[model samples]
Target chain A: MGLHFTNGYVRKKRLQIILLQMQHIIALTVLFHHSYQSKGEHLRMTNHSAPTLNELVSGVVDRLKSAGPLYYLLLLITLSLVIASAVIGLLAMFRGHEHYYNVTREIPWGILISTYVFFVVTSTGLCLVSSIGHVFGVQDFMPIAKRSVFLSIATILSGFFVIAFEIKIPWRMAIYNVISPNLTSNIWWMGTLYGVYLAFMFAEYLFLLMNKHNPAVICGFSGSVAGILAHSNLGAVFGLLMGRPYWQGPYMPIYFIASAMMTGCAVIIMFHILGYKINGEKMDGDMERALEVTTKVGIMLICVILFFTTWKLIAGAAGQPNGAYPVVMSEVAGHHAFSFWFWEILLGMVGPLVLFILSKGRNLKIMLIASISMIIGIFVMRFNLVYLGQSLPVYYDLGVNEFKEMLTYSPSIYEIIIAAGGFGMTAFFFLLGEKVFDGHKVEHH
Target chain B: MNKMDFNKLQNEGVENVPMQQRRDFLKMGLAITGIFAGGTLLSAASTFNKAQAADFAKKYPYSPHYSMVMRQDRCIDCERCMEACVATNHVPNVHGAYRTTILEKDTSDAIGSTKEFIPVLCNQCNLPQCTRVCPTKATYKDKTTGIVMMDIKKCIGCLTCQEGCPYNARYFNEEKKAVDKCNFCIDTRLARGEKDTACAHACPAGVRVFGDLSRQDSEVFKTVHQIEKAVWVLRPEAGTRPNVFYTKG
Candidate 1:
C-alpha cells in the first residue's frame, strides 16, 4: 500500500530499499536460527531430513544474491508494476470505477475478467498435468510435478489478485460468500471450490517440501479433483447463461476441462525448461522424458481442441442460427476475424502444434518458443471469448437502432495496467519461488 | 378464396401486425393453421386454438401478483413514462442506465403504422434469472407481490445478474455501488398506497395498464385472459415466465 512515492523517488531509492530488505531478511534468518537451534526444535524429521526453516531462508538469500543481474532486473520491474497496479486498484475503489475503467452499463465486464479466466485456466491445467505424474504415479510425469504444483499456486493467486479489483465490493463478497452462500449460483460454487483447491495445493506443497510422500499424494489428488470442479463451474458461469446464446449449453464446461488440460501441458513444458535455465542446471534424462510425454499430450489435446472448434464454428454458422449466427459471423468475417485466425487459431493452436512436432519434445528451445507462442495466443483467446459473447446486444434480434449492431469495448489504461500487474505478480512469485525452492527439485521415491 | 394466390397478397411484416389481426386475416375463408417456412407459407389443418388457458396461468401463485399489460399499438414514443420513472425512482441521468425506456422499430412495410414504439421494463418474472444466478441473495422476488427487489447492501456488483437477465433491464448504480433495477415502485409509491406505477400513471395514451393479476376482475388479468386479442411477452423463448404482458387493441 506504500506504492505512492513519486517516480523519481522510486528510481533513486529502489536499489537502497532492495538492499535494506535483503539485510533485514538475513538478520531475521540469523536470529531465527539462533533461537530455534538453541532450543533444539526439530520441526519435522524425515529420513532425508528436509532443509530446516533457517537453512531454507539463508539459502534463498544466497540464491537471490548469486542470481544473474537479469533476474534482479526482471524482479525489480515486475515488483514496481505490481506496486503501481495496487495504487491504481485502490484509486478505482475510492474514485469510482467509471473514471478509471471502460466498463459501461451495456458492457460491465472487460479485460480484468478475461485475465482472471486466463490465469485460472492455466492454474487448473497445471494441477491436472502435475497430478498425472505425482498423484497417479506416472513415472514420466513425476519429474515436472513439483514445479508445476508451485506454479499452479502462483497462477491462481494471480487470478485472485485480478478478480479482487474487478468485484466492486470485494470485502462484502468475502464475508457473504461464506455466511450467506447461494447454492444455485455457479460463481459461488466456482469461488468456494477454488478456495478449497488453493488450500489443498498449499498443504500438498508443504508436504512435498517436508518429504512426506503419502500426505503430499493425498493432497495432490484432492487438489486436482477440486481444480477440475472449480474450473468447470467457472465455465458454467458463462455456459449456463440462457441469455448469452454464444456461450450457452453444455459445450463450455466440456471445452473448459479439455482446454485447461491443453493449457496445463503447454505451461508445464515452458516453466520446467525456464526453471532449469534460471538455476543454470542442465536438463536431466528424466526431466527431458517428462517434457517429451507432456509434449505428446499437448499434441493430442491440440487435435481435440481443433475438432471442438471446427464443430463450434459449424454449429454457429450453418443455416445462420438465431442467436449464435451473428456472433459467429462477426468472429469469422467481421470485427474479430483477425483475432480468431491469427491468435486463437494460428499462434495458439497451429503454431504451437507445428513447433512442438518439430522439437520432437527433445529440443527445449523449440518447445519453449512454442509454449511462449501458445501462452500469448491463449491470453488473446480468453479475451476474445469474454468480449465476443458480450458484443451482441441482448435486443439485437428486435432490430432497434441501439441494439441492432454489435457493441464494441476496449480496455482503458487503468484496466491494462491492472491486467499487466496480474502478469507481474505471477512472474515475481515464480522468480522468488525458483530460488527459494531450489528450482523445485523432486527427490525420487 | 379457395386455392388463393399467396404471392398476390402484399407481405405485411409481422413486426407491426398483432397476432389477432393475422388470425382475423386467416379467418377470411382461408382457415390457415399456421405460418411456416419463416412466415412465407401458410398451412391449414385447424391448429388454431382460441383459448390459451393452459399456456396462460389458471391459478395465480402470488396474492397481489402485481403485473402490467402494455397496449403496444398505442405507444407514440411520448417518453413521458420514462420521465415519470426517472423522477419516481431517482434514476441517474446517464446513457444506457434507465428503469424504463422505449424501443422504436421501423415497420415501413406494415399494413398499419410505418413505425412502432414499445415500452420495456424488468418483467419481474415468476422465475427470475437475476435472483437465481445472484452469488448472494442481493436481488430476489417479493413473496407477497412477486416484485423483484434488491438489497443494496448484499450486492457485490459482479454484474453477473446483468449478464443473466434476458431483458437487459438491470444496470449498476454508481452511487449505490450496487446493481439496480425496476422494483415496480414498491419502495417509492406502492408502499405509500399508490395503486399504479409511475410509468403507468403518467401514460396518456392508456398504453400501460398496471394491476394485480390475481383478481379475475383486474384489467391485467382480463387483458391477458381475453381471446379477442393475442397477448404476448417479449422473448418468450427465454422462458422466464414473465409477469408482464403486451397486446394491441
Candidate 2:
C-alpha cells in the first residue's frame, strides 16, 4: 500500500512541476509582450502621420482594384495553384502520407523539407540584406529595403504554409510546443524563435507602412536578430546529430548563416529588378545605385560560397574519412557529380559571378539572368544539402543487407505539386503586395 | 583453427549453427566491433578497464536501471523474438518498422562462423538523443523506469527524433501518426508485473538477456561488469551511453 501511494504521489508531483514550468513560460511571454508594447507607445506618439485605418484599407482596395488584365491573369493562375496544392496537401494529411510522399523509414525527409529550408533561407536572407540600409542606416542600401522587407514576410509565410502539410500533426505542435517545451531541442528553439521573428517582421512592415522610422528600425533589428538565431538553430537540427557524419560539427550553422547572406544578395537583386518591371517604372538614380551595390555584394558572396564549397570538399576528401568520404565522393565525382558541377558549382557560383562582373553592376538584363540562374542553382543546393546527409546508411559498415547500400529518395508528384504551391504562394503574395503598396515606394526623409 | 583456411569454410547459413559450439571468440570478439563501420565504434578492449566492476557497484541513476545484454555469437536469426515483439507490441509488418530486429553480418574471413547475427532494439540510453531532440517532450525518458517512453498525443510528427537516433531504432507509425520504438516492454510486460521483455522471453538461443542493472546480482550487471571478454555498444561516439550491450560468451 505504501509503495503504490508513493508511486502515485511522485507521478502526480512531477506532472504538477511540468505544468508549473509551462505556466512560467506563458507568463514570461505575456510580460515580454507588455514590455514591447510600452516601448512602442513612445514611438507611436510620433507617428500620427500615417493614414487612418479606414483610409489605409480603402487605399489598398483601390490599388488592388486598379490592376490591369495581365496582373489579374497572373494572379488567377497563382491562386489556382495555391488552391489545388492545398487540397492535395489536405488529402495527404487525411489519406496518409505513405500514399502521397516518397519519404520512407530510411529517408523520412524529402523534398518538402528541402523546400521549407529554401523558403526560410530566402526569408532570413532578405531580412539580413535589407537591414543593412534601413536598420543600420546605410544610405546606398535604403532604396531596396521596403520591397525586400515585404518579400521576406511573403517568403516566410510560404515556408510555414509548406511545412504545415509536411508536419503530419501540426495542430498538436501548436498546443504541445508551448505546454511541453523541450529546452534542449534545437527544433523547439528554431520553431519558437522563427515565430518571434515573424511577429517582428510583421511589426516592422506595419511601422514602415505608417512612416514611423524609429519603430520600423527597432522592429527590423529585432527581426534580423531573431532570424539569425532561428536559422542557425535550424542548422543545428542537422549538425548536432552525431550519428550523421556528413552534417555533424559547427560547420553547418556557420555555413547556414554565411550562405544565407549570399542568398539574400541574389534574391534582393532578382526581386528589385522584377518589381520595377511589374510597375512599369524606370530605375531612378538611387534605385540604380542600390541595385549596383546589391549586385556587387552578390558577386562577392558567390566567391565566398565557392571558397566554402572547395574547403568542404577538400576536408571531406583529405583522409577518405570513413562515413564522409563516400558521401563527398558521391557529390564530387559520383552519381551526384553532374548536379555538383553544372547546378552547384557552375550555375550557382561561377556563372553568376561571371555574369555580375560582365554587367559591371549596371546592366539590368545581365544581372537579371545571373540572379535567375543563381536562384535555380541554390534551390538544387538546398536539396543536395538535405538529401546527401541521409544518403549513407547509418549502419553501412555492419555489412547488413538492409543498411549496406545508400538510401535514395525522389519527390513524388504530390510532393512536387506541394512544393510548387510554396512558390505559387510567394508569387501571388508578391504580385498583390507590389500593386497594393505601389511598388513599396521609399521617400527620402 | 589457424591451420584451417578461413575463406574455404562453407556458408552453412543459420540451419547448422551448433548449439553447443564454443570458441575462444576473443580474437574475433572485435569482429562485431565492425558495427562501428562508421570509424567511431571504439572497442571496449581499448576503453573498458578492470575498474569496471567498481564502476558497476556504484549506484546507477535509475533505481531499477533496466538494461539488455546481447550475446552476439548465440543468435542464429530464428526471428522468434521479432515475432514475439510484434505480437506483444503491435509492431506493424512494414519493411522498416519493427520493435526489435536481427541484423546479419557476413563473415567470409572469420573462423568457426561464416556469418553472425546481431539483435538490436532501443538502447534506452542514459543520454538518449531521441528524448533530447524531441521538440514537444512527446518522446522522453521515463523518470521512474529509465525507459524511453512516448506520449503519442504530444507528438508533432516531425521525425526529428528519427534523424537524431544513431541506432535506427525509431519508425514513424502511420496508424498512430507518431514515432514508435521499443520501450523495453515497459507498458506491455513490466507494468503488468513481468520481469522480462517479450524479446528476451522469446529468444530461444539466449541471445537477449533483460535485467535490472541496479541490482548487482542481476544477469545484466554480471555480464556487463566482467572484464574477461570485450563488450561494446553501437555508435559509442554518439555519446548516448546506451543501456544495451553486445558481447561474446
* lDDT leader: 1
Clashes of each: 0, 0
> What's the true lDDT of residue B135 in model 2?
96
Using TM-score, give the best candidate's number.
1
lDDT of 2 by residue, B1-249 (tens): 654788778897855755544244544466555544412344553344554646644425787899999998899999999999999999887778897889988868776668888898898988888988899999998887789999999999999998988888999888888999999998999999998999999988998999988887999888776655667888787788888988876
Provide the global lDDT of candidate 2 against the true structure: 0.85
Docking class of 2: medium
Give per-residue CA lDDT, model 1, range A190-219, as digits (tens). 999999999999888877766668999999
Query: Model 1, range B11-78, lDDT digits (tens) per residue?
Result: 87788999898767856434222222312221111111233445334335788999999998899999
Q: Where does candidate 2 stray beyond 4 Å? A: A1-62, B1-42, B45-59
How high is each candidate's TM-score?
0.87, 0.86
